[model samples]
Target: MIIGSSERVPLEKCPALVLNADFRPLSYYPLSLWCWQDAVKSVFLERVSIVSNYKRKIRSPSFEMSLPSVIALKNFIKPTEHPSFTRFNVFLRDKFTCQYCGDKKDLTF
Candidate 1:
């Protein structure tokens, strides 16, 4: 379990969902998630604004607050209008299946 926090949740138990300035997910196919450390750092750096938070809290001699569950970038980043051809892109386009075998299980590569 992690320390110096109000909640004793394991570090891996919570990850903040990251979003673009428009409030849409940064990446839909894989879903953008940032670890707690990065989330907190982004908050402190003012690179991102917290949209939502978990009940869990972290504390320091100087400050104490809940961990962000969702965050959005302060500046907008445009997504590409077209996706490049790659194996991962192909899988996302194909819904992660082996087209020839019709196998959708664990097509991770």
Candidate 2:
């Protein structure tokens, strides 16, 4: 989708949505996104492939290129399995500390 903007678009609005090599979002909960600078760096490094572009383009002394709206990694990265939703995991996340009371002596669910 093309977003209309003025002569110059702000850098904050040019965040590139990062996707895996499989064309899926790297992170769904947080929504993987990289700034314009990182996106351009990745493109130059050949570490990522551009999937889509934004209407705005950035100009530099050497080159000028359109900002990428969506980018996928060139190499596929194995996805980490989700942690099991268990009481032990919950306790581990909490660092064995009591959530309700400040009592660190006894912690139980």
Candidate 3:
């Protein structure tokens, strides 16, 4: 949809952070994010509940709403038995400490 003739923030930059049914982020490593288009579609489809919103507003002939900064699912997807193996998850499990030297600074994989 064509939007924002005068607004300074690019629509591309206004991604919404997606959350689980329990109000926790859907993911942390890469972050479960949705683009403005998908986020707006989900709003119309009522698949998510808005948790927070940006100051910007989007309008149509029939309706208008502030752009969502955060949204949560209406349904909960149960977590799998085992968490996926990701570098961020590994770092979290390790408590961000060096596995070999126990150093807590400048960690790198």
Top candidate on lDDT is: 1
> After superposing candidate 1, which stretches have Cα over 4 Å from the reference?
1-6, 101-108
Kindly give the stretch of ten consecutive residues in candidate 3 with the minimal lDDT sum: 1-10
Q: Mark the regions of model 2 whose C-alpha exceeds 4 Å error after superposition.
A: 1-6, 84-109
- Report the C-alpha displacement of residue 37, candidate 1, in angstroms: 0.8
Please tell me which model should have the higher TM-score, number 2 or number 3: 3
Instruction: In candidate 3, list every pair of residues with a backbone clash.
Output: none
Q: Rate the local accuracy (lDDT) of all candidates.
A: 0.87, 0.84, 0.86
Model 3 ranges with Cα > 4 A deviation: 1-6, 86-109
Q: 39-74, model 3: which lDDT tens digit per residue?
A: 999988999999888878888999988898889999
Better of 2 and 3 by lDDT: 3
In candidate 1 the C-alpha lDDT for residue 53 amounts to 86
The Cα error of candidate 3 at residue 42, in Å, is 0.8
The residue-by-residue lDDT of candidate 1 on 1-109, one tens digit each, is: 2223346677678899999999999888779999999999999999999988887887899999888888999999999898878899998888888998999986867
How do the predictions measure up, each by TM-score?
A: 0.81, 0.70, 0.72
